[model samples]
Every structure is written in C-alpha cells, then in structure tokens.
Target: MKVGFVSLGCCKNLVDSEQIMGVLRENGHEIVGDPRQADAIVINTCGFIQPAKEESINTIFEMSQYASKLIVTGCLAQRYEETLRSEIPEIDAVIPIRDYGELAEKLQEVLKDAGNGSFSKSERALSGNPWSAYVKISDGCSNRCTYCAIPLIRGNQTSKLLSEVREEIEALAEHGVQEVTLIAQDTTKYGLDNYGRLMLADLIREVDRIEGIRWIRILYMYPDEITEEVLQAMKESSKVLPYFDIPMQHASNRLLKLMNRRGTKEDVLALVSRIREMFPEATLRTTAIVGFPTETEEEFQELLDFVKEVRWDRFGAFTYSREEDTPAWSMSPEVDEQTAQRRLDQLMQVQEQISLESNQKKIGQVVEVLVEEREALTGRYRGRSRADAPDEADGQVIFTSPREIEPGTFVNVRIDEARPYDVAGVLAE
Candidate 1:
C-alpha cells in the first residue's frame, strides 16, 4: 500500500514521524509524498497549544476528503482519541504515542482491515535535512509547568540509554549527517529519570567524540539545570556549538513560581551571566510567553527588562494559549486575546531592534555558514551560521559565490550587510 505521512510541530515530533516512515518502508509499503496518490494517510500531530490543535484538526479534515483510511497519531491522538473517533467519521485508526519498538507489527494490526503485508524492522529513516537532523535523546516531560499540556499528552520524563543515544548518533553520522541537534522535553533533564542524575554533559562529551558529525547543538535546556560542567563540556568540544536554547517562559518571579517553573528570577539572571562569562561569543536563544493568566503590565515589563539585559541572539515569543487540563486553565483573571497579542507585539518589537543590533555587530566578521540550498534564478546561496539552526527560523546568511557550491559545504562568509533578522554577505577567501 502507498501510505502518505504528514507530520506537524517541533523537531521531536518530526523525529517520531521519521521513525514511523521508516517502519512503513521496512514493511514493504510504499511511502508516497502526495496525499492523493496514497491508499492511506498518517498524521503525526501536535496539540501542544490551541493553534497546534486547530492545525491538526484541520489537517485531518483536509486529508480526510480523499483518504479512505486516515490514522491519527502523536500528541493530539493521545490527548483526544475518543473525541476524534466520535467527531471525525473518516478516521480509520488512532494510535497513541508510546514506545515504538515494534511499530511495524502495530501498523499491520492497525491495517488489519486493509489486509496484512510483509513486515521488516529498521530504525528511523533520515527524512530531514541531509546535513542536519534532530536526535531525540528522551521522551515525555516531568516538569509539569502550569501552562503546558506536555505532561498530560506525553507523560513523565523517560531518557534513552546512553549507549543507545551514542549508537543512534553514530548511525546518523554514518548516514551522511554532519550536524545533529539533540532534542527532548527538557534536554538538560536527560538521564535524570532512570540514572537518578544528570548525564547530559556526559552524553555531549561522548557524542562529541563521534567522527563524522561536524556540529552538535542541544535544545530545550532548562535554565537552572545547566551547570558549569555542562558549559565547560560544550566549550571543550569542537563539534558542540555554544548555542544555548533555554526556554525561560517568563522572567518574573511571581509568574514563574505560579507556573511551577523551577528557577527564580535571580537564578535566571545568574544563569545567563554565567553562560556569557564562560563562553563570551555563545549564541543565546530563548522562548517566552507574553500573557499568562493574571499577568499584569508590571510583570510584562519585568520580562522585557530581562530580555534587554540578556540580549538574546535569537528570541521567540508566543501569546499565552489557555490550554485545557493544565493547571493554569482554571486560574482567575484570564488574559484576553487582544491583550495577549498586544503584549506579544511589544515584546517582538523590542527583539527586532536587538536582533538588528546583534547582526550589525557581526559586520566584517567572517563566520562559517553551512550552505543549505542555492537559488537557481540568481545563483545566490542560502545557509545558516552556528547561530542558526537547520530550519533557519532565526535567520539565514545569503551569499553569492564566485563558483557553484553544493549544499552541506561549509563556507566562510564576510558579513557585509545586516537586516532585522537576516544577514547578507559574500564568500570570503
């Protein structure tokens, strides 16, 4: 059978979809790109926020028109299995997210109505960029942040074995992966569940020893858990870029405490200061929620001030989405959509200026950028520096090379111009 797969949300979820695709291929099933040509459609969804849920629902509906069999999996399926079955008449099956060890067999069981087929076993296929891929170190969330539905959807934290992680990355390196971004519910919490201690730093040191990997970036690190030893490990590894993706949702002590975040205001400030103290040119990226329940202008201002002080190289801000079953859902003084959007705009406006200034500072400095693709029309190459991830959501460096260059080639580019979010440059000899 020709199966079509559509995955949505963060890289962690994407990794799951990749593994599912691998299973489909191993089972002698054809994985088609176009939905119209497939016998069945599989949707690996995200229901992390309100918008994500809407997208997932809409996607299922859209795919349902032509799909005789539609299988819904991932967070949304786990969260709303009964709701989907009752409301969506077209869905054939719903598989909750769980250990996918023998998922090929499971897929056959799900496809019992469609008739069984040959099943083989293999690991996740490399569906993402050839040069870069997301290596999920763990699954689920233990930090029950009040506003987040991750714990409810994905359950508590579970770390993969250190050897398994190493083997995965080693296989990825062998499969032409040059850059690997380690992802988890909380990357800093890796090995904490089963090992009874933090082994993230140790894991990094081990992955850094792998031969073929050029860049290893870790994401979703909790601010307080990032010890000096971790930073030191990052500093020592040539392959490990100094990019800290700390998701400090809010900077106000009151809001943070109310949200059940681990760190205090002082701890956050100290954490940033310490990171900069250790790695002066380290790229700092963070995420924040603008308006939570009962969030006053004073608290917003505190967060704004903190952002200015931290001068994050890349910043992402989202308006608070009041999710169901989360602790904050029933909290009084719910922030209205208008207020939330305004706060979000104000925060992003400040970040725009900060980003421009940050880029301007890089003018004339040669930076190594991994060429991702080239414009056929203009012969311009688009790529990302160490500061940018594979998605290039933060920004990209566009350069015109004297000669044609292939994607995945690392070239030094001298920064010639700066925009609010991107940089224009020329290849440096």
Candidate 2:
C-alpha cells in the first residue's frame, strides 16, 4: 500500500506525523507524496483554533477525493472523534492521539492487504528538510491557561525520558541531521512530571555532546519558567543557538490573570531585559493574542505598548478564538469578530514596523546561513541563520554564490539588503 500523509499544526504535531509515517514504513507500506498515488491517506490535524480546525476539515475533504481509505487522526480527531465519525461517513478510520500506542496494529488492520517490508530502526520517517528536524522532548501541556484547550485535548504534560530524547537525537545525528530544534508545549518545564524537576538545561547539555549535530535550538518556553540554569547551560553550550521563542499571550496584567498565565507584565519585562543583558546577540521571538474576553481598548493599548517596548525580532499575532469547554468560551462580554479582526490588524501593523527596523539593523553583518534551497530561475540561494527557525514566521536569507552549493551546507553571507521579514546578502569573500 502506498500511503499519503498530511501533517497539520505545529512542529509538535509534525513529529507525531513523522512517527506515524515510520510505523507505516515498518509495516511494509510505501509512502507517497501525492494523495492520488496512495492506497490510503492519513491526515494528522490541528484543532487549536477556529481557523486551524477549518483547515483540517477542508483538508480531510480534499484528501478524501484522492484516496479510497481516508484515516483522520491528531487533535481534531482526538477532540471530535464521535462528531467526525457520525458526520463524515467517508472517513475510514478515526484514531485519536491517546491511541497511538496501538497505531501499528490499528494501521495493520486498515492496510491488511498491503505487503510488509523492512524499514530503518529509527521511529521517525522524517519529512521536509532532511538536514534539519524537530525533536519533541515532551508532549501535552500542564499549564492550564483559561483560554487554551490544550490541557483538555492533550491531558497533562508527559516528558519523554532523557535517555529516549538523547537516543532520538543520536539517531538523527547519525542520519546527517545538522540542526535539531527541541520542542514541547513548554520546553522549560521539561522532566517535571517524570524526573520531578526541570531538566531542560541538562537535556541541552546532553544534546551539545552529540556528534554531527551542529546547531540545537529550543522553542515554546513559558516565560515564567525560564531559569538561570537553563540560560547558563545555553550560554555555555557550543551548539545551542541563542534563540528564545516565548509566547506571552498578552501584556495587560488583568488580561494575563484572566488568561491564567503565570507571568505578569512586569515579570515579562524583567525577563526580556535580563535575557538581552545576558546575550546581546540573542534573537527574541514572541506571539500574542488580541481581543480576549472583556478586553478593553486600554488593555489592547497596553499590549501594543508592550510590543513596542520589547521590539521582538520575530513576532506573530492571532485573534482570540472561543472554543467550547474552555473557561474563556463562557466569559462575559466577548470581543466582537470585527473588533477582534481590527485589533489583530493593528497589532500586526505595529509588529511590521518593528520587524523591518530590527532586520534593517542587520545590514552589513556577516552571518552563518544553513543553506536550504536555490531558486531555479534566479539561481539565488535561500536559507536561514541562527535567528530563524524552520517555520514560516521567521525570515529567510537569499544570497548569490559564484559556486554551486549543496542544500545542507552552511556558509557565511554578508547582509546587503533587508526587508520586513527577510534579508538578502552576498556570499562572504
């Protein structure tokens, strides 16, 4: 059987998709890039926000048209299994995230007619950039933010064993992976449930010792949990990049309390200040939500002011989504759709200016870029620096090279031009 897989949502979900792909390969099924060429299709979906849910549904319908067997899994399937089974009779199977332990057996039942084959010992069949991959150190969220449905969907945080994480990275390193980004719902809180204490710093140090892994980055760190130990470990590590991806949903103290976030506005300010003082060359990235329940104009202004004060190197914003069963869903005086959209626009506009100014300052600086691809027509190479992640949120570096360069090669480029979200440069002489 040739199986086509569609992975949606964040990097965390992508890791699951890759693991599932590994299962399929181990079971003797061929993986196809196109849905039309598949005997079955698997959609690993996102149900985090309204927009994401819509995309997941749309993709299900789209993929359904291509394959005879349509299997739906991931957050959407986990959250609304019954609804999907009842409403979408076209779906052949609906497997939730919790049931992944039996994924091999379940998939075997679905694809019984397909022949078996041998596969790599690694549990993940990596997709996208072969040289760079995301390694999930943990799954789910313990932080019960009022507005977030993650706790409801994923249950409590379960940190992967330290040895397990190290083994995965070592396998990736052996396979020629140069950059590995450590990801979780809250990376700073890793090992709390399993080891009874935060062990992100230890994990980083362990990864630093791994051979062939040139760059290590950590993402989705809750601001309040970032400790001195973690910071120092990153500072001392030869491989770990100085990239912080802290998602401070809002800046208003009142809003923060309502959202059930741990840090206050002043706390975040001090955290950002301390980080800058510690690593002047560090890249700070953040995300924010606008139009939460009872969000007043003054509160929105406070968030704007916070963004200006922080001047995040890379920023992303989303309007509030009212998901059922969450505390915020029933909160009084919800922000209207128009108001939410307007606030989102205003927030992004401010961020655009900040981003442009931030990128502009990088002009004339020489930076190491992990080459990703070269434009076919223009023949210009495009890649990312330590400042950028593999996600679309970050900027890319485009440069001209006199010589042909392979995709996974890292080279230095001197910045020549800057845009709001991207920088262009020439290969350093």
Q: Which candidate is the best by TM-score?
A: 2
lDDT of 1 by residue, 1-429 (tens): 888999999888998888788777766778888999988999999999999999999999999986678989889998998999898988888888863554555577766533222212256767767878898999999998999999998989999999888998899888889999999999999999989999998998999999999999999999989998898899899899999999999999999999999988789788888888988888899999988999999999999999999899999989988898988999989888899999999999999999999999999999999999999898999999999977645899999899888899899999999999999899998
Residues 1-429, candidate 2: write the lDDT tens digits. 899999999899999889889878877778999888998999999999999999999999999999999999999999999999999988999999888877776676777744242222327899989999999998899998998999889999999999989999999999999999999999999999999999998998888999999999999989988999999998999999999999999999999999999979899889889999989999999999999999999999999999999999989999999999999989989999999999999999999999889889999999999999999999999999999999998999999999999999999999999898999999996
Off by over 4 Å in 2: 113-122
Tally clashes: model 2.
1
Highest lDDT against the true fold, candidate: 2
Cα error of candidate 1 at position 329, Å: 0.7
Model 1 C-alpha RMSD vs. true structure (Å) is 2.0
Instruction: Note the Cα lDDT for every prediction shown.
Output: 0.88, 0.91
Which pairs of residues have clashing backbones in candidate 1?
none
